[model samples]
Target: MQKVEVSDRDWKHLLDLRDKVHVPGSPAGSNSNPCMSLYRPLAERTKPFVLAQVGQSLDGRVATPSGDARNVSGSDGIVHLHRCRALMDAVIVGVGTIISDNPSLSVRKVKGPNPIRVVIDCNGEIPADAKFLNDDGESVILIQADDVDRTINGTQAVKLPRRQSGLDVEDILGALRKLGLNSILVEGGRRTIARFLDAGVVDRLHVAVAPLIIGSGPNGICLPPVHSLSEAQRPKIDVYNIGTDVLFDCDFRHQYQQT
Candidate 1:
């Protein structure tokens, strides 16, 4: 990934809005700059927030069949993700993402504090040296099954009661809440984000669509089947351009189900 482009004056507002991202919600209106208009919802959070993001091709493929996803989002999408990480209190991923991408999960592209790193490893499957576990003075929480006695260095092992589907989404969120990580970003592989989306806990979803089209690859999202158009989710959407990618910011705040 490329370093943060500080010279993009159009999006320079992002560098300014990175830290001051949460205030009480206000009436909606469009701003002249798409950067400000697209990011307004994030700053208006009045309660705990959970959001997920995915970058894919126009054909909806996140990676080739061989699992080569490097540079799929291009430079701008990568920068946007780093900004999101800076704005959130914590960033989460599943064991699959750790094994596949080995992401550092830090706000390296922008100038801001790194969010606490979190991993949902139900049975302690991720290796100790995974990049996400690299100690940077910030907290790291490994959510595993209560029966799993294993622990990882550079992390606070927080085990919760597991359910049939690994661990219940509600249980995981509750555990994070007690740790004071309110603004959460579920930055992950498709399965993990789909699990959270299916649980109806995600407050927003960002789908950044790139221009490339890989005919055979893993899709950006795979959720439980919805029979028809009416049965599907119809979120309030705000569109914006981030370089060669088009971002569809889907607001699901009112759709979140309280536990």
Candidate 2:
């Protein structure tokens, strides 16, 4: 674990955050808790913790129709992302994100250890020359549905049962936990986030809304159809301003889960 020396101003900000944090049994509004986790399925409490993040435009689009989505969030938002990546044991993304963004998924902007990179490539689609496989020291784990055993450029491939939707999330998490990972950050394209959400296994959701709006593009989360507002999800949100972007840090497990 790395130790950071907080400045007085940062310390004051920490003090101010106390009232902004909210948890189920905690005070109505408190941000004092430095760490927050999603409510795990009873069986998954022993599994690795999971958190998902999304950066969308004001109109809820992750990318434009042409599949261009670079720098949707400002530098501050980008830094916030790297910081979050810096704190996790591993960072996960769907194959679609890799094809679209070709993200390095490393903690370059922040001062912390780089985490294990997890890619959900159910099909064997990722090209052999993918940049993620080139990182010499960083650990890369690819979850694929294909039964053929294979390895590419030093990347370890974990085979799991496949569903029409994608690789089995439960099996994926189980494999990750078995690898000794205690926490994971799920950062991705829409389908990936949807899988975790539909599974009801996500513990935390961090949404950073940029100031711009792209009238049409890919939506962030593809949830099931709901008949009325009463059935809609109402998460307990903690708001924060990261430069020009606004963050909606939400804990869905407590608000939506039935005890």
Model 2 stretches with alpha carbons more than 4 Å out: 1-47, 256-259
User: lDDT tens string, model 2, 85-197?
Assistant: 76667899998898888888998875556789999988778877777777575789999987756667788888888777667788888999889776788998888998898
Question: Candidate 2: global Cα-lDDT?
Answer: 0.73
- Winner by TM-score: 1
Report lDDT (CA) for all predictions. 0.79, 0.73
- Clash pairs of candidate 2? 18-31, 21-30, 21-31, 38-203
Q: How close is candidate 2 to the true structure, as a TM-score?
A: 0.81
What is the Cα-based TM-score of model 1? 0.86
Residue-wise lDDT of candidate 1 within 4-65, one digit each (tens)?
A: 22335423444344445433332222354465566645544457888899999999999999
- The estimated TM-scores of all candidates read 0.86, 0.81
lDDT of 2 at 137: 53
For model 2 the local lDDT of residue 160 reads 88
